[model samples]
Target: MPQEFSRTERVADYLQQELAKLLLHSVRDPRAEFVNITAVDVSRDLRYAKVYYTKLGVESAEAATDVTRVLDKAAGFLRTEVAKGSSLRTVPKLTFKFDESVGRGRHMEDLLGRARASDALRGNEAEADDS
Candidate 1:
């Protein structure tokens, strides 16, 4: 059988976990606060990594930009920190991206809820007509 996960995928998983910890306790920038790493995509050659994150506790467009800037500026430092924990020959260049899926998911849920309410209201009206 082939390997369950390719080298790039394994690296991505490792980066996601280590980056989360580093951002949680190692990074001291206030702008970097509340960063949650949703996923990491490592290039097939392992030369680059794109980290997807979401801001917690008062997320805003401006705040998201600030967090992205801070993370990008600190990419070298984060990479070094990550290197200390892994045996890879070279650490991938880090790139931070604000994960929009979470926000989209919330929006989808809101739309679904409204649809359910509308269906319920229609059901009540039908019952009244039947009485």
Candidate 2:
């Protein structure tokens, strides 16, 4: 019978959980304090993993950069911790990436709101002309 999830998917899920715990309690960098792991993608061979993360309290570009820098620097230590916590033969190399989807979504929402407001104003103007 075919399995629902492949080994790499299972490993990625496990790593995501472990990494969240490590980032929350073990990592002490102030820049990374607000960091939240959003998702993890592991390679099919299990040799590499890309970790997507976002900040909680701050939304500035500089703050995002700082968080990414801190996480990237601590990747080695985090990988070691993962190895110690898991039974995998080889822990995947960690790569930290700032997740921009949240920001993009917010921007899109703002644009949509502006468009709606403009449409409503135009509709009111058309009614005034019709009267």
Candidate 3:
């Protein structure tokens, strides 16, 4: 007997393929602005998937809701698209989710820059004290 494929892996692959198509062809979301699918996580049973996406252009909290609503509405279409794209027997449901990792990483970089500036200032002060 062939080993069964895990639900999580199946769901991840489905989401990546379907969302890419929707972004390229089907979706007509007004709030769309260079959205990138960063990652995806699927539950054990393949019922729901948490999609991680980031916006490259201007992004706002209100825009996020519109994007999500469009994605939710297009889930069925996405499922069909995924089925067509993959060789799997089943495709898990798609769920659009905002991934904050991109934002968090940006925030951390800002903090690091500040810390570096502060360290440089202190080093200058130490040099002045020695003089």
Model number with the top lDDT: 1
Sorted on TM-score, best first, the list reads 1, 2, 3
Winning candidate number (TM-score): 1
Residues 1-131, candidate 2: write the lDDT tens digits: 99999998898889889999999999998778867788899998889999988888655555678778888899999999999987899999999888888888888999999999999999999999999
Clashes of 2: 0
Clash counts for the predictions, in order: 0, 0, 0
lDDT of 3: 0.74
Pairwise lDDT winner, candidates 1 and 3: 1
**Model 3 agreement with the true structure over 88-126: per-residue lDDT tens digits:** 667767788777666777888999999999999999999
| True-vs-predicted CA distance for residue 111, candidate 1, Å | 0.4
| Local distance difference test, candidate 1 | 0.91
Off by over 4 Å in 3: 1-7, 58-63
List the candidates' TM-scores in order: 0.94, 0.87, 0.80
Give the 10-residue window scoring lowest on summed lDDT in candidate 1.
57-66
Model 2 local distance difference test score: 0.88
> What TM-score does candidate 1 get on C-alpha atoms?
0.94
- In the predicted model 3, the residue pairs found to clash are none
Taking the tens digit of each residue's C-alpha lDDT, what string does model 1 give over 12-112?
99999999999999999988888899999999899999999998863455558878999999999999999998999999999998888888788889999
lDDT for position 1 in model 1: 90
